[model samples]
Target: MDPGQGKKAVLNRSCRTNTSFLSFLCVYTIMKWALLSVWDKTGIVDLAQALIQHNFSIMSSGGTGTALAGAGIPFTEVSRYTGFPEMMDGRVKTLHPKVHGGLLGRRQIDDAIMAKYGINRIGLLVVNLYPFERMSRESLPLEKLIEYIDVGGPAMIRAAAKNFKDVAVVVDPSDYPEVVKTLSSNVGFSHEQRLIFAKKAFARTAAYDAAISNHLSNLDNTFPPILTLQFTNGRMLRYGENPHQQAAVYGTTGIAGAEPLQGKQMSYNNYLDVNAGTALLAEFEEPTAVIVKHNNPCGVSVGTDILEAYLSARDVDPVSAYGSVVSLNREVDKKLAEAIDSTFVEVVAAPSFTRDAVEAMRKKENMRVLILPERNTSDEVRTIDGGVLVQRTPAYQENWQVITDRDPTTDEMSALRIAWKVCKHTKSNTIIFADQKRTLGIGAGQMSRVDSAKIAIEKACAPLAGSAVASDAFLPFPDTLEVAAKAGATALVQPGGSIRDDEVIKAANRLNVAMVFTGVRYFRH
Candidate 1:
């Protein structure tokens, strides 16, 4: 048999044997040809076997061909079929015109041209890009990383996806079962199924390119020339901030991906409060508890045990703690679960919950209980009217310079650290008063700094005397210091960069208040 004639000779012979072109066209459409080139070999052998059973010829190359041969599943080597050798260490294997022409060829329209070029029609394309993302995380050199960029893979994927009307592209291994099922049912992929697969294939290639772009951009600049953001696995939410607005959550990690074990559907407000609470809770290493309401921390405390921390944190502002999101650094046990069940909390996030604790919390069936894993900090993004804003704080440490005549005592310094951590996460124009282990008062999101100080004093659950105060920003005037001193705050911490710093320091000395400067400002607006 002449390899050059191949399937084209069969069609030509049928036409010469008094057979109509329409009959030959029917035979060509039913004779499926699948091209399989993948980095992930999972389920590839099984899929190839199924394709062969369905009377579909398979073409593969490199490791895919090796695996298929090892599994005793007969397949045509891509290089053999293309009449081109796999040169450049297999990099130049699938970039030939035959591969693209097969994937992108139109039925009946390009049949003559395809036959002339010996390009077989590819009905199915199964491809996955190289492990660029996984290798990017590894300690590989630039030259090695470039090899994983996957040039031919993405090109072939785009071609097949663009010709979805004639080709079915599969990039995800999870969809292999569906393809097998469809073939077994003797019904080829429907238009809708092909379109869906094509959309997913394009998205996979786009995300792959985005990863490469973002990584290279980091080496040259802080951000890329053109930012491309992609998130997958979108879960539709019941509603947005209100019932009238539509919303959906995307991404598969961190708070955006968390799903409740057993509870009512999470709302937009619930996700916001939980995100804020978990972020603040991450700052503590001890058994700490953080309670958030309306995107603000109502109470925060560190104790010897999680139960004590939860109790003290809740007591800091019991009124605001109602129906709030609670986050803890430690695991949730039965005792803590029972204690949480005593209140009307909306969500509880922790590393883990014991079996007994889950049973105890069953009393409140509507409460959302989820595991909050450690989350790495990424760029902060916010949307405005015209576009969006992106900001990131480089790694830093607090200066913690004592600027007043009197330095903070040991207990005051400990309280100052706690207050500073809470203040960093709280809203701007905020004042946080804390004792050694727990916050005594919190004033956040006020218009004026002096008003914030006054509100903190007014909201104190415990005596403000012998407590430390932390302001999110520098004190522009001595009036806030005077107000805090008059309220019995013995020590204060603020970012000292205001023009009136000298006057504020003098007032601190005059009022016998200890003040420290932390050259970093934490303004959360």
Candidate 2:
């Protein structure tokens, strides 16, 4: 045989013998990759080290790369891997096809495509967007806030999340430990775990976009053509208004005030009742106590002493006050705690609690104790079928116009003012009867104003003589006025914008009831 022929034969034989080995190497070699590009560096070092221990090639960009290098954890720069430097002031770092292809590659379905493009599979993705919400709240310029809006971060997150069947995407640092545990378990992330992460990833991006949209809209108009609201789930309540309905509480800003100190979890009704009590208590600067039941103020009072205020408020209608949420504007002491303990209250909230009060509260293990911060005023949002109504919080009864011939006495005026403030928080067609700055009877959520008046009188059970009455809105007809007069209400306060304002005033004058028009309507529903 010729030498050249012999060499060719030998080479062909060698290739045939190694064919199976090459196929096995291509199909079975375990290659794991983790891409970490995060604005938050929390738990990144430990995660990177764990990935390195599992033989994962860690790829990072910008600050994340710097952090890994400082921590002595080996990582490959994303720019280096993609062979493209970050451009556009570091905005174009990870937008390349190489990065996305690695994240989106399907190991079983798209292996040929990935192999053709020299795309490596990325098994893990850890990314968090820029703090748009935090920066928007700061006094930064609009241009600065716009710059903080993330572009590439959300893109990578969505891409990874789209391929969640094969790729594990983590946006919250709190999930780092679970991710590390799964990777170390040798079985890797299950499909269910990946799906959960993907759901959270989508929600994170949605909330981010909503915040940006709302901030931009606020600059142009208070009532935008299309309203967008973003809320973070604050708590999952034990139940909704009813036990059978599923419920969770979401807040636009967060659960700022109303921090629960002890006791059972809050229910949806409990939250509504607490909000009603707090809103009513906010209207008074003095030591005030408000007892709210079923989203209505059943009792309210203001006094020099906090204990006295609570006792007086509770005494108005102890039957309706049972299982109510009680809120106070002052610190709760041992005496007030003992008094509250006497009742079967659902929740007790105050600005502060003395040591003795906290100790006394421990006796009622099922009663919820909450320490509330000073209330912050924010816009009110109500959801309808497919839309929401946003408006400024109902303004206090600042401008009053006395329509009656007889002006109110000093004590009557004070009581009328308190009743008006409480009426703003009550439901529509509401009537609140009060005297000496204490609520005597409250009838709310009735269909007719006359019924509300009658209910308030019946709830009072005693003669409403000399008590002041507050109507949440205009008296649509004179029947309410007649009912109030017959109930022996000596003074009345209302928004007074009905078509029958003349008739209502005539009835008030005929009954010798001092009526005042606030001009601003507070129709809460």
Model number with the top lDDT: 1
The superposed Cα distance between candidate 2 and the true structure at residue 430, in angstroms, equals: 1.8
Let me know the TM-score candidate 1 reaches against the reference structure. Answer: 0.96
RMSD of each: 2.1, 6.3
Model 1 global lDDT (CA atoms, 0 to 1) = 0.91
Residue 374 of model 2 has an lDDT of 60
After aligning candidate 2 to the native by TM-score, how far in Å is the CA of 399 from where it should be?
A: 1.9
- Residue-wise C-alpha lDDT for candidate 1, range 1-525, written one tens digit per residue: 122335555566665575457455536543568999999999999999999899888889999989998999877888888888999998899998999999999987998788777688899999998999999999799999999999999999999999999999999999999999999999799999999999999999999999999999987798777777899989899999888999998878889889999789888899999999988888899999999999999999999999999999999999999999999989999999999999999999999999999999989999999898658677888889987799988888878899999999999999999999999999989999999999999999999999988888998999888899999999999999899888888999999999999999999999999999999999999
Off by over 4 Å in 1: 1-12, 16-22, 25-30
Cα-based lDDT for every prediction: 0.91, 0.85
| Candidate 2 lDDT tens digits, 267-383 | 788877887788778878999999988888888998889899989899888998899999999989898899999999999999899999999999999899988766667787888
Give the per-residue Cα lDDT of candidate 2 at 409: 97
